[model samples]
Target: MFYWFLKWVALGPLLRVVFRPQAEGLENIPTDGPAILASNHLSYADWLFMPLTLPRRVSFVAKAEYFTAPGLKGWFQKTFFSGSGQIPIDRSGANAAEGALISAKGVLGKGELFGIYPEGTRSHDGRLYRGKTGVARLALETGVPVIPVAVVGTDVVAPPGKKFGKVTRPQVRFGKPLDFSRYEGLENDRYILRSVTDEIMYEIMTLSGQEYVDMYATRAKAEAKQAEREAAAEKKAS
Candidate 1:
């Protein structure tokens, strides 16, 4: 399949030589069967470099834009993203979050690795943001173990809102698989969902060593922008 081709034959080897990515706790990933890889959202490259270290294919949901571009370049991009295990999801709808969970659950049901960012969005700053509870729901609904993974230094490889940056090596760390079976059949309980999500975030915090911010990244960004506007208005009045 194209996934294996990219992972082992061409792209993987070239990336290994270029980035020289380092990985730890590889033993935590199951050699076979289904598992949820709940990781912190550092940068777009987090998906790339993390999966580069794994022998099994890890699929992540991506915006449909990546596959909808036109022209020859778009064709190549579509092929590459598709081959690299990025599934296109229509994230424009109100039920986008629920849809993503369904897509992830399908992958897990197939006994394949499904990667998700618990933070929902890439952190605007380098610090780790509070994770969304959808990951916990997926884990509970699918009965798959959640592995807290940290892809450090990827923000440098490709910053959140910019093009590729420096060529520094990115480190991928994997924590022990977290079992949440005790909370079985409680997926609908919002309180239980938050608790499980927090536990996963804690493990990611340890692995990533980034400052923990209790606010969601989107809200923080919005608030910061509002503050900036207020400051500008005050300056203008002066």
Candidate 2:
């Protein structure tokens, strides 16, 4: 009820008008039952644009920081994310991966559409990074078909810290459902998990047309921050 209300009454119309997203292969999404919507993370706008285009309620696993923000901005973030049915996951420590898997399994068990960005974090350089194997684990464990989705042009809408930029149209492409049921009962097999994750990433790459990186997005983000700090120190010394 609140989901539809928020979509049609508040967010849906506004986003459609602003982003002017072009979606394809939406029919690939099953009308009912559980499925995983795996996508590549490009920008913060990817969160807004991707869910808005989906006809069904797709719940994503968002970081816990979004829920703990302060002041009015924090309130809005918490409210919007909550209303959108996003699950909050604490991405800290060695247990974080296990915790996320538990949350995802719960969502899938309830016959819901679970949305996940296998890259673990947004791509700072607009290039698709190697996907984490969590997605494959979820699909293999839950026996849910994975739908590869791609969102293009969101990087232009809101890239990194620069928000409220020029309004550029976005495009979302949903690929056919991928079944990894053949690898059933093989969740413990690391080789199978990597193979499945790579296959899904390949499909996302085809849809988004971004260069694939062998490294993880988290690593790339760390490198970017280090470079920024070094540059700042150099300027200070000069």
Best by TM-score: 1
Whole-model lDDT for model 1 versus the true structure? 0.92
- RMSD of model 1 against the true structure: 1.5
lDDT of 2 by residue, 50-167 (tens): 8787777888878899899999999999988888888898987688888889988888898989999999888888999999999999999989999999999888888867876678
Candidate 1: segments with Cα more than 4 A from true spot: 232-238
Task: Report, for every candidate in turn, its global Cα lDDT versus the true structure.
Answer: 0.92, 0.89
lDDT of 1 at 40: 86
Query: In lDDT terms, which candidate is top?
Result: 1
Backbone clashes in model 2, listed as residue pairs? none
lDDT of 1 by residue, 64-161 (tens): 88999999999999999999988888899999888888889889989999999988889878999999999999999988999999988899989867
**Candidate 2: minimum summed lDDT over ten consecutive residues — where?**
158-167
Judge candidate 1 at residue 49 and give its lDDT.
92
TM-score of each: 0.95, 0.92
Decoy 2 TM-score against native: 0.92
